[model samples]
Each structure stands twice: as C-alpha cells, then as structure tokens.
Target: MSLMLGYLEDYAKNRRGSHNYHTILVMGYAVAGKPEFALQLFGRMRYQGIDLDVFAYHVLLNALVEGNYYDGVEAVSNQIKSRGFESEVTHSILIKSFCRKKEFDRAETYLRRVMEGEVKIKGGGYIVGALVDGLCKDEQFDRAGKLVDEFGEFHVYDIWIRELVRARKLDGAMEFLHKTRNVVQYVPDLFRYNTLIIRLLRENRLEEVCDLIIEMRESNIPPDELTMNTVLCFFCKGGMVDIALRLYDSRGQIGLSLSSMAFNYLMNTLCGDGSVVDAYRILKNALEQGYFPGVPTFSVLAHALCKLEKLDMMNELFHVALENNVVLSDRIHEIYIQALCRTGRVEDGYYIHGELNRLNKVTTGCAYNSLINGFIKSNRADIAVRLLIEMQEKGHTPSRQLFRTVIQSVCETENPEKQFQRLLEMQLSLHEIDCGVFNIFIEGAGLAKKPDLANEVYQMMKRSGISPNVTSDILLLRSYLRGEKVSDGLHFFHNILERRAIGRKVFNTLIIGLCKANKPDIALSYFTNIRAKEKTVRPSLECYEELIYVLCNHKRYDKILDVIDDLIDVGRPLSSFIGNNLLLHSLKDRELYDTWVDSRPPTELTQPESSHIWRLREVVGLFSDRFRDDISIDDLEQVVRNCFPLDIYTYNMLLRKLCAKQVDDADKLFDTLCPKGYEPNQWTYETMVHGFYKHGRKDHAKLLLKEMVQRGFRPSEVTSALL
Candidate 1:
C-alpha cells in the first residue's frame, strides 16, 4: 500500500502528463481506493495545460459512474464540452454511464439518439445487463422486466432474472419468469433454486420451502449442492436438525457431489445450533478433502463461540478469517462486543470496537449499543456519554432504542435533575433533542421539582414541529402538580379535551388527579363532561374508587349517597375503608345519625350485613354515655368483633377515641390491649395523655408521655402544650 501511494505521489507531480498517463494514473488511484486523490489528479492535470482525450475522459467518467457521483459526471461532461472531443465513444460512454448511474431519463435520451443513427454504441448484452441491473436497483422493476422480456431468448436472460432476485424483486422476477415460460434456456438452475430457497428461509416460510423443493423434483430439476445447502440452512434455523441430516444423507442417492460451499453451509447450520463440535469435525474433513471454507464461512463459528461464551475460540476464528482474507461482517463484531459486555469486560468491548473502526469495519450499531448500555450498567455515565459523542462524530446516528436506553439510565441516576440537565444540554448542542428525548428529561424534571425546565423543553418541541404524545402531556401535568400549580394542570387538561385531543387514558388521568388533589367537585364536573362528549365511555373501577375517596373526604354526604346508588347498580365491590370513614364522619353521634337517617330513604342504608354499617354502629357505641346503661356491653363487643376487622390504624383510631371518653374503663381496656401488640400511634398517645390532663389525672398523663417517647411516638406541639 505504501509503495502504491509513493507511485501515486510521483505520478501526480507530472503536470504535463499525456492522456494515456492520465488514464493509467487515475485508474491506479481508484484501484488504491483513493477516489478523492483521483479527482485532485484530474484537476491538477487540467491546471497544467494537459488536454484530456476521449480515453482520459472515459477513465474519469467511469470513476464518477461507479462511485455514484452524478454531479461529478456532469462536471466531467462540461469539461469535455469545453474541449472538442464530442465523438461516438464519448456519447456511448455517457449513455452507458447514465444507465449505470440510474439516470434513466438521460440514458433514454442517448439510447434514442443512438437508435436514430445520430450516435453509435457497442451494443451487446453487457450494456443491456447494466441497464437492467440499474433499473432494478432503482426499483423500476417494470422497465427491467420489459427489457428481460424483450431479450427473453438471449443466453444472458437468466442473468437478468438473478439481478431481479438480487434486488429483492421476487414477485416481479417470478412474474417475468412465468411470462417467459417458452424460454427453455431460462430453465430453473442451481443459482435460481438457491436464491429462492434462501429467500424463503429468510422469510421463515419453512413450510412453503418444502413445497418449492418438491415442485423442483417433479419438474425433473435435481437439487444441486447449493440447493441442498439452502435447505440445510432452513432446517438449522428452524431447529429441525434431524430432518436436515436426513436430507444430507440422501444427497448421495441423488448423485449430488458436495462442494466446500455445501460443507460450509452445513457447518454454519450446525454451529448456530450449539453443535460446535460437529461443525469443527465437518470443517476439518472438508479441509482434508481439499475444500476450503470461504470468508463468509467463519462468521457462524465466531458468532456461535460468542453464544457459548467461548471468547478465546471466537478470537481464534476471527484471526483465522483475517489470515484467510475473509472479511467479517459487522454482525460478527457485534456478537463479540456483546459477549464482552455481558461478561462485565466493558473496557475490552470498547477496545475491540476501536480496533474494528481502525480496520474500516465499524458498521456495528449493536456493538455501540452494548458499549453504551454496559457503561450505564457499570455506573460509568461519563464514558457512555463520550462514546455517544464519538459515535456522532464517526457519522453513525444513534438509533431510537439507544436514546431510550440512555434516557432510562440517566433518569434512574440519584440526582435525576442534574443528570437530565446535562443530557438536555448535550442533546441541544448536537441538535439531537426530540419529543421522546425531551419527555424523559421532563419526567426527571418533574421528579426533581423543576417544572421550569420541563416547560422550556415543551416549548422547544413545539417550535421544532414535534407533536407531543400522551406521555408528554402526562409529564407536563405532573410537572404542574409537583410545582403546586394545580390550576395550570386543570386548565391544560380542559384545553386538551376541548380541542378533541382526548384519549381514554388522558380522561382517566384528569379524573384521578383532580380527586387526589381534593377537588371532588372539579373531578365530578370533568367526569360529567366526558360522559356528555363520549357517551360510550364505560366507567372503570379506578374512576369509581377515586370518586368514592373524593366524596368521603369533602363530606359530600348527598353525593356519597348518589355514588353508592350507582355503585350498587354497577355491582362492583365496595371499598370498606372509605365506607367506614364516611359513615363514621357522617354519624358523629346520635343527633347527627338521626339527621342522616331522616334524610336518606330507609332502603338506601339497609346493607345491615356489611362491615361498614357495623363499624358505624361500633363507633356510635363508643359514646356510651349518649346511650343509656340499657345498651348491652355484649352487643357492643359483638359489633366491634363482627362489624370491623382490626388493623393498625383501626386499633389506633378506636383506642384514641376511647381515651377521649375520659372513662376509667377506657384505661383498663388500653392496659389489656397494650400487651397484644396493639401499640398505639402518635395520635393515640397524644389523645390518651391529653385526656388524662383534661380530667385532672396528671400522674397518668406523665406515665403516658414517658411511654410515648420510649415507643418512638413523637407527639405534636398541641399534645406537648397540654403536657
């Protein structure tokens, strides 16, 4: 390579080179993969009074054509026109060049000029095949099919069919095949069968593959070694190794001689199935039989070694590939990197990625992803960030999934706010900030109590023509709620709904948020608005639970009654805690209870067997002084046992209110209960201590205070003030 560069440098110094030298030197530069240097040489030749002939122009023109430089072709054309070398070879080269370039219009212009006898082309299958291949690549399948049809009897018509298949125009190619049924020379060949079977395998049409193979047999077209290799690949991928082996044995009966290509496919299939030992045996035997597996043949072993966590074996095969002049695909490199990352050898993975980049084989998106994700997993955010910037500089655009992984990683970091800010700044500088990336930042902002940053991103998204999704809207609502801007969240919900931007989830979020914020009236209004707008909206259990909690908190007794009616009709399970709390609050004592009973119909509150009603009765019985001595103690005990189950908070509430009764029996009851693991809460301790002081039992209050502190129950200022 150094010798080739030295020659190029020496030849480029000759400013007055002849047309022959110019063509030779340009071709040499292109062969050395220095197209830029070739263009520079051409420019220098023009500057030094060197006149380019048709042959010199053809060399530069073909370079532009092959390198996909359409504008460069036009520049060369203008340079040619400035001179006077407008001959038939120039025009034919232009026509064939346009065809190769997929400029079908320009190609058609020159082809018409040639057909009208204004110009001449060295007309043959080579030029036709070039046009057919380019048209198929350009997805002008109809035009390519027409050319194949027009030249159906030509010996190279089968070649055009192969081109169509290569371009993945299976349907069009098959249609052309059916139309040219009379062309006996285009009969199904080994290449055709291999192409079809490979495609079917890729498409996972294993069942259809069997049918095609059977059809080949019936048509008297024996499956060649390549055909058998494709079938073996299909079976291996489908995990049917038994059937693939059976077919392999039957190859001899069909008089088929297996080539090294066939053995390599067999090994690839076996290696991918975790049968590395079997693959090694096959490869060794093939080598002994004077068959060498080609370059693509090593990827299977490399990837398989990676899958089996045998990195040493994988490296051995990769080096073998390098020695054998086999170019490894990016996927093989990706597998090795992922294996390194998975084993916690993240630095090794990065090193391998760098080596691959230096080799000009850095097309590994998965390898880059593994490096980033591994850094995140190892808590090395700074390194992951540097890698992302490095990837962008290398012209590799990170995929959406990569962004997702990065966002998720940063969001989970301890100081999410600072992490999000850094990410936002980085993305903004690189012009990589989109709605999805911004939404993650917004989520972190809400968590960090930074609504201002979230809103700024929201405005940026709008300015950049990015439409926000439901998650974005929800994040904004959370931001407002976190900032104590409840009205803003409410207004945003209302505006989104008014604009008919309402989805079921958004409606449910608004309802639950309002209810949670203690705005029961607002929640009810939104529910009513949704029902009016979308009458088909079926209420979910979540909505009902929210409404029940909201109604109980706001003491909307009448609304509670109406809600209970709807709930009963709906026939879902009643929330016992909300029901007990609501009933207890409504029936403060006998006077409040009498008013509730008088207002409600007798049937509305008649679930006598329910725990809610029994708890209500139990709470009423606590005010024993209100009831006469005629109320049975047995009846009260039964109510407490059967009506309400005891939980930590339930025991606390009962014990606190019992102390508030200022009864000597209440103290006796507390003494009995304290031994049963029913330790009182802060509220319970405060209630008992305060009750003792209010009733002039200072000695008992002091005892309660000491117990409270010992039990880690810190009473509030109000309770301390009484002490």
Candidate 2:
C-alpha cells in the first residue's frame, strides 16, 4: 500500500496533475480505508474547484462509516444526499452505518423503508447480512436468528452460521444447520463445515467431527483444501490409520496439498503407531510437497528408524534434516551416533561428533561411550584415548569400566607408551594440577597392566608440586600388585612403612590385591600383621571376602575357618559373596563342613555375635537337606533372606543346593525368585539346566537351554555337557 501511494505521488509530480489523478487519489484513499486522509483529499479537491462524482462521493461516505467516524458520516451523508447521489448503494451504506453504531433496530427500520421503495434493489441479501452480523456481534443471537429466519436469504444464512461458529457457539450453529436441513436450495458452504470440524478436531471431539464430515459427504458439498487437510489430521488423531492412508494415497486424484501443521501431526502419529515404513514414505512425500515437518516429528521418526536399525533410511533422513537446517536434539544425535557405531559406521559417527564439537553441541557421556568404544573396535585406540581425555575436559566423567576399556585398547596399539604419555599429558594440561588427575592416569595405567607407566605418572604428580593424596598412593601400590610385580609392591610398602604412612586403607589394599594375585601367603601375612600391631584397625569386609575366596579356591578350609573367626571378630555381617562362596565350596568339599564344626570353640559359641558362625553351619546343613525341619521351597528363600541379602550369585547358590537332589523344588524356586526383583544370569540358567539334567528330565533341560539362549545367554561347558 505504501509503495502504491509513493508511485501515485510520483506520477502526480512528474505530470502536471489532472482532475482524473485528483479523483483517483480521493477514491484510492477512501477505498484504502484511510478516511481521514481521504476526507482531507476531498477538501483539497473542492478547494481546487473539482467535485466528486457519485461513485467517489459514495465511496468516501462508506469509508467514513467503516472507519466509525460518525460525525464525518453525518456530514458526508448530508452532502451526498443534497447532491442527489442517493441510490440502493446509498441506502445500503446508510443501513450498514446504523448497524456499525450497534443501532440494529434503526437498521431494520431503514431496511424496511428501502424494501418499500420502488427502486427494487438487486441482491438485497447483503443489506440483511450486515444487520445479522451486527446483531450476532452484539451477542443477540436470538434476534439474529429471528432476522435470518424472517429474511430467509442465502447470504444471511451463511453470515449467521459463520458468525455463530466464530463466536464458539458450535452447538447453536449445528442446531441451526439441523433446522435448515430440509435439502432446500440454501445450505451452509464447506467453509462453515471446515471451521466447525477444525475446531472440533482441536477439542478432540472426534464423534462430532466425524458426524460433520459425514454430513459434508451426504450434502454433496465439495470439500476444499482446508477440509481435506483437517480430515487427514483428524484420521491421524483418531487413530484411524487405514482411512488416513486411503485418503492420503489418493492425494493426486483428489488434488490434496498438505499444510505444515497437518504434515507434522501425520508424521508424529505414524511413528507413534509403529508404522515407520509408512512414516518414511510420508516424510519423503511431504518433503516433495515442500512441507517440512516440525523438529519434534523429525526426532520422533529419527528415533523410530534408529531403533529398528533401518540405518540406510536413517542416514538419509539425518542428512535431510541437516540440509533443511533442522536443529536435531542432543538425544537424537546421541542415538543416531550410537546406531551408526553399532552398524560399523564409526567414521561417519566420528564425523558427526566432530561437527557437534565444532558447533558446541552437548556431546553426552553415552555418545562418547559409543564413539570411544567404537574407535577401540576399529583399531583407533589413539583416538579413543584422546576422546576419553577430551570427554573429561567437556565435564563428562568416564566410568572406571570405560577407562579400563580405553586403556586396554591403548595397550594393544603400536607404541603404547607414546599413546599413553600423550593422553596423560592432554589430561594433565587440560585439568588443574591435582592428585585426582594423576590418580586417573595411574588407575588407567594400572588397569592396562602398565605398572611402569603408573609409577611414572605418580612421580610426575610429585614433580608437578602436587602432594599425592591417599587414593593416589593406593592406586600406585595396586598397579604394582596388579602387574604381578609383588617385589615392587613390597618395595613401595616398605617405603610407606618407613615414612609412617602405612595405615588401615593402605593395609586393606595390600591384603586385597595380594589375595587377588594368588599370593595368599603375603596377603595373610599383612592381614595378621595389621591385626597384631594396629589392634583397633581391622580389614574391610571386601578384604576378608577376597582372602576367603582365594583360600577356598586353594581348598584351605582350616585357614578359611580362621578368616571367618576374624570376620566375626570384626563385627561385620557376612556379605553375600562371602557367604555364597563358603556355602558353594562346602557343598563340593565335605571337609569344609567338618573344619567349621571342628574349629568353632565351645566357649566361642557363647560370645557376642558368634551366632553368625552358627548360622553359616546351619545353612550348610540345610543345603544338604539334613536340617531337622523339612523346609518348603517357600521357606527356603525367606530362610536365606534371614541370613544374608540375596544377589544373583546367592540365588545361584540356592539353586545349586536343590539342583542335584530336589530338581522340581529348584525349578519352582527359579520361577518364584524372578518376580521378587531378581534377574537370572548365565550361571542361574546353568544351575537349573544341571538340576533338570540330574533328575533325568532331559526335556526340561533342553527347554531351559533354549530359553537361556533366547535371553542372550549361552550355556556354559557344564550346562552344555548336561544337555
């Protein structure tokens, strides 16, 4: 409008203006609804001794009325009347002026007066349509309906229903449509139905929307693009996928052009319904139609495709999103990257990850796990270790397992020292000078079995002017023991002992690591030495459990009984690992039971907390089904619960108890324990398989093996031999 006005003004300046130009200016401003400017132009035209023709005169008058300039309306209408510019147009404008002022009664009276005139206006329904619209705006729907009923004009009916729908009086509009449902010459057009259906769809009033859609088909009223899109969205929302697909498939025949909103809803609903193939097709078609679904819909589909391993399609969709400038969410990117790595496309995932880093997107810890592990599998351990360091710099803490995985990969690579040193340097440079950074390096090296590198990192920590904390000392000592360099561990132990830093946590580490490395003699030496000198200090439960485990593996039950005595004296309850280990071994070695019975001092039974040793004896006897009471399978788990917390390993022990003798009881126990929040492991399955096979129930054993394989577990050697 501004550009047109500028062009008009320029034309007037270049050519000495004429009356025609002046006339157009007046009418243009009037039709443009700028009554003030048009009226001002009117005054100028009069001053230049030019007057408006009837068309311009009526145009200016209507503009005043439409602008609600009542004072100007009265003045202009009086001038228009004096000039004898009166016609049906003048009367129509006058009636509209009355209605615009909310004078519906006066408007009706003027309408009657005009109808009585012999001028006989053609298409007079517009005059009544204006009155009905005003009445409806004033919330006088009763009066508006009455006027429409009396006039019975096609245009008035259209205005009445459209206004009623706009006013959210949908029931009243539908009721009025029902009243006029006589299949007459007049009926509401598809716009009114589209308005009603669109609103109902939004409100999830699917029943009413369905009814109206059927009504449209019955009335033979041709549906428009809006109606088509609304029906498509309606089907998707209503879970009417077949109908939606039928309609969508016939789009070319029906000339369907989808809007963006409908496109998004359809895509999201299709993905929700697990129709990813159909959704993929719709996505391609929508893109062809220049309709880009919303970011949420794109992510929903991306997740679906990734979950189903439709990687080729997912690859295409991801690039399509990027090319269209869709900002994929972090979760979407993470899953996509993981899927790519799972499909052996680590380099592609790496490129995407690099792009995310360049764009400063939040690369989550899970995504890094996938990429780091993926690169490890691809023989790119250097990159894997570097990414591990970079992840920590980006505020992600790799778990101990993750650190071990990367370090193990580094150990396998050529020139591992160079790779490890570079990664350590990157970690040290990016982090503050602290023992924690050094400890991570030391721990990683220890896990990789590089004790020399671990010691180098420890010395580097001291050289950097940072005091090594207790964790640093422990990790360093364990590195040597873990690398089987017991000589180095003993050397560090003497150094710490000379410096007077040997304490409870350090002694516990030595005992546990020595036991783990099969040097039970050294571990037992430290355990006894710590107990002798530091009477107040005792080994941790884990330290006792490790000693018991390695000793049991060595079949030294007398030493095991001595350890249990120390364990009871420590005032700690037996952990499931310790208890399960002792029980499973006693089942194999009859001497263990005899050792426990022989080693329990008669007076020690009277001591405080000595009942735990008695409980272990009872459990061993109970497993042999030699207890006094014949316990039911129901009592079996509860009895164990009274003794120790049941883990997967504990359940495996319990299953082993009945596997040989009471195989049915073992099967029942297996089925019942799962609902109590216990997940079965490979050994759990093996226990049941062995139990079934022991009872000559080969069919049950075969079934159990099949189930085990289905649950992602393969039978162990013993389990396979039983089958």
Candidate 3:
C-alpha cells in the first residue's frame, strides 16, 4: 500500500493531468481495503487545485461506502451532483450501501430518482439485482417481483424463482416463467431449472420433476452433480433409500463424479427419516471411500439418535464431527440441545450449550429460548429466569412467549407482589411495557382479587403512554366495585360514560352492584343523570327497576315521583312491576300519597283555576264512604259539574274509584262526561267494564270489552280479568 501511494505521489509531481491519475490511484487504494488512504488522496488532490472529474467522485463514493462512512457518502454524492457529473456507478454504489443497511425503501426511492433522470444504469442491472436480492432475503418477494417487472430485467429472475419456491408458490413461479418465455422470448438458464427441480423433488412432486427433466433434455440442458445430490437427499428423506442408492450407483454411469456433499445429503436425509442405522452404514461407506460427512450431517444423526433415546450413539457422532473440523450451525446445535432436554437430559443440554457459547455460536435469542423453555417445562423456572437475564445481558431481546412462560411460573409462587415485580422487570427488560402487557397484569390482579394491584397496573399503563381501551376501563370498574370502593367505582363510571366507553353489560353490573351495596340513592342519581343527558348512557330497564325498588324501600318518595315523571316525559311506560309497587304504597299511605300528589308543579295542572282538580280531590275524599252506601245520581251530577272540562285521565281515575264502591251513579257520571265533548278512550271503556262487572252486569261488561278490542286496544291484565 505504501509503495502504491509513493508511486502516485511521484507521478503527480512529474505528470500533467495528475488529478485523473490520482483518482485512478484512489480507486486502487479503495479496492485494496485502504479506504482511509483513498480519502486522504482525495483530500490532497482537492488541496492541490486538481480538477476532480466524475471518476474521482465515483471512486471516493466507493471508498466512503467501503469504510461504512454513510455521512461521507452523502457529502460525496452532493458534490457529484453539484459538479453535474452523471455517474450511474456512483448511484449504484449509494443504492448498494442503502440496501446493505436494510434501508430498502430509501434504496428504491433513490433508484426511482435515477431512472426518472434518464441515467442508464450500468453493469447489466447490478443496482436492481442487489435490491432484488435484498428484498428476497427479507421475504419481500412481491415487491421484488414488481421491481423486476417494471425494469423488464431478468438479472434477478433467479432470485425471484428461488424465493417463490421457498414460499411454496412453485406453480405461480412456473407460470411466470412460461409467460416470460412467450412475451419476452426469454429462456431460463440451467441453474434456474435446477432450482425448480430440487424444490419439486423436496415437495415430492415427482410428476412435475419428470416433466421438467424431459423438457430440460429436449432443450439440451442436463442435470448437474448438485441436481443428482438434491434428488438423492429428497428420496432418502422421503423413506425411499432403495431408490436413493440406485441413483448414487448410477451417477458414474451418467458421467457424474461422487461429491462429499452428496454423501452428506444422503446421510442427513436418512437420519432425519429415522433410519439412523442405515445412515450410519452410509457414513462408514463414505469414510472408507475417503469422503467424510460435515457437521450438519452429524448433527442430524445426533438429533435423531437422541430422539430415539440413544444418547451414547449421539455422543460418538458429535465427537466424530468435531474431529472432522466440521462446524455446526446454530440451528443444528439448538436442535441437539432441545432433543436432550426433552429426554430429561437437561444437564447434558446445558453442557452442549456451554460448548456452543465457547465456540461463539450461541448469539441468537432462539438458542436461549430453547433452553429456557426446556427448563420451564422441567419446572426449573429459576434457572430459566437466570438464563433470561444472561440472554438480555448478551444484547438479545427476550421474546414475548419467553416472558409469558416466566410470568406464569412466577404467578404460581407464594408472593403475589413478587409475581407483579417480575412481570414488570420483564417488560422493562424487553422494552415492551405497553398497554397490552400491563393489561395482562391488571386482569391477573382482578382474578386474584387484588384491586389495589389492578389499579397500580392501570396507572402504570397510562404513564407508559398507552391509552386504556374499553376492556381496561371495564376491568378497573369491576375491580373497584368488587372492592366495595363505591366512590371510586362511581367516579370511573362517570368518566367512562362520558367517553362512551362503557357498554350495557358493564353499566348494568355497576348499577346492580350499587343497589346491592344499599346505595340506591347514588344509583338513582346516575340513572337520572344518564337519562337527562342526550347521547349519554341509557341504563337498561332492569337497572331502572332496581333503582325504583330500592328508592321506594328506603322511602325516598320525592325521587320516586321524579323518576316516574321522567319515564312519562320520555313516552316510556312504567314497568308493571314498578307501577304496581307505587300503587300499593299510595293506597297503604294515603296521607303521604296526598302530599306527593300536591307537590306536582302547577304546569302539570294545565289550568290551576280549572274545577277538575277540586272535583278529583272531592271524589277521592268520598272514596271512603261510597262503599258503605249507594250514592244518588243528583250528587254525582253535582260532582261532574265541579269537574267540568275534565281530561280523560282524571275521568278514568274518577270512574276507577266509583267502580270500587257500590255507587249506582257511576254509570250516569260516565254518560254525562262522554256527552260533554269528551272522547272515550281505551281507559274509559276499561273503567266502565270494571264498574259493570262489580255491579254483576256481566253482559254489559262483555259488550264494553268487545268494543275496546274493536278499537284496536289490548286490555290490561286487570281489565281482562274483570271481563
């Protein structure tokens, strides 16, 4: 590197157009893994007033990317644009850097800008191919396919085909290939055809494999050694060892040399299919032939032997693989550990885990998770927790499933607070202390009958900036009510009601709880308030009935009347249960009833000066005497005159009172009231039927009942029984 730098210095001092020569030298330095030297040369060139061309900028950009100086790359990019140097190579360098950083969206955006600027991308779609490969690696096959289609480039076709096979969309991929051939006159190469055949063999699509082979032969494309190995492995794994051996023997006849990978593939497949003895025989034969299987093959056999409870054999295979200098993948190691742990050999599993750690192979959370789950399954949660801490300390985030396992174990402990603290610790460690995680704690507290802890969790959830959902509100509301914290329950009730969060079931629960706690006054206030506010919660009828029953039992007469008034104003009929209770109380306590009646507002009278009020009062007064003797018709007439212009409601009440007594003038009073421009309603007919039935005039009562039914009026239960 120093010699090259010295040569560049000597040439720059002795040559014209030294700037161009220096840029070439910078590229050389960058290619040699000395990006800093390239950058230093660039700076020196600028200081010497050298004319930096597009090539210089391109080389400098590559240097910045190689050094992972993202900011420096951007600065060089801006310089290239400012100098009006259109370098497709520079654009591709930026795209590749962004893709390597997993910033695929930024890469796509920059690519689109370059395309829109009419700059022809160089190097046979290298930029597009990098993006496509990155997207495929990220499992974004759909985006990759769209990008390839937009560019009409087949450079990334192999990637799309491989991804489609991996995703199990082999048919779609085949159809795409057929369409590309027809529309663009494009032909797939041998490697792509091999990829399809291998995947088809793995999926056991023998008919498609046969057809593809026939098509390949017609196109003068023959299967390579890798293809035969893939087929051999597929047949062995599918429990067709006989066919696999035949294929292995026929490889020499087909002008193919035996490869170690082919031998490993056969042994691995045989072990995976539970033919460990057969796989061992194959391994021995391969060893005699100077071909040794790799770590993946040995790991597969070890896992199979461990599954069959043959740990002795598994250990021998592990030693052999180590002696062969074969390096096992983390997944293979994890599989071995999991098998041992499953067979009640967790100590052995832990030893293997330690060995892997020594080899720097235990880096992923998945490896830790397997051991953690194994420990948890064996009821050694403390060990699992220790392992979890170790995992996090190694910069691996614990999965939610791992945390849940530990939490469930913690909850089984004697101390509830310890369980809560452990869960909180897990959340903090994972940086996942969101509402969902806290909701679990809140629900757990409620189930454990720990309302205080539930409230704590709710507060914590809010402080964590996760707004509570309807379930959260409902859980907390129920917790407060269950704890007999009536004030807090009601406060939450009001808050949720305002937010329109409480559903009918939750509201009913709260109301029922309040009534059961002997706090019907508070419940009644809530009921009334909900009714008065438009778009607020409307309590169920059962809730209203509970409130009315409790209010009457407590003798809150004013509230009862108010409730009745509100029900009437809303055109909602009072439930028969509540109506009957009010009627019973009114009759049993006449003075209190009279006071309630007198407390009605003057507006309800409709006309304070009207005689209907006086007449109704006088009729109620004679209710006590009319049962003892028959009243004369002239006295009934005088009473009717006092109530002149009486409404139908008052008339119905007067008729109902008279029917309870033996007063003969009740019929005359009804006759006089109807002739005085009063339309006889259903209640009027029902009242006369009761009068006739009480007077033993069943025929007249039947006529009135028939007339009431004809007027589309269904009789009340009381009126039907009377008829």
Top TM-score hit: 2
Model 3 regions lying over 4 Å from their true place: 1-262, 284-291, 299-325, 338-348, 393-402, 419-423, 426-453, 459-723
User: Which lDDT values do the candidates have, in the order given?
Assistant: 0.68, 0.82, 0.70
Q: Give me the overall lDDT of model 2.
A: 0.82
Candidates sorted on TM-score, descending: 2, 1, 3
lDDT tens digits, residue span 333-427, model 2: 99999999999999988888987887788789999999999999999997898788889878998897887778767866779888877777776
Candidate 1 residue lDDT tens string, 1-723 = 679988877876774445468767777776676666677778877787765667677677767766767677788877886776555455655766787756798776555555456444445445455566667677787787676666444434666778766777666666666555544534667567678778767867777678667767877887776777667766766778767766766776876556665566577778767878666656655666677777666777777878888876676666666666677888888889999999998998888787777778764666788899899899887678778767876778887666656655665667765766677778777766567677866765666556666777787778879888778898877776666677988887776666565776777677777777778998887787776777556566677778877776666655655555555555545554644464345335344344345566766456565645434534444543345443333354455556445554554445444555534655665675668677667766776787788779999999989999999888788877777
* lDDT for residue 353 in candidate 3, whole number 0-100: 75
The superposed Cα distance between candidate 3 and the true structure at residue 258, in angstroms, equals 7.8
Per model, how many backbone clashes are there? 0, 0, 0
Candidate 3 TM-score, C-alpha based: 0.33
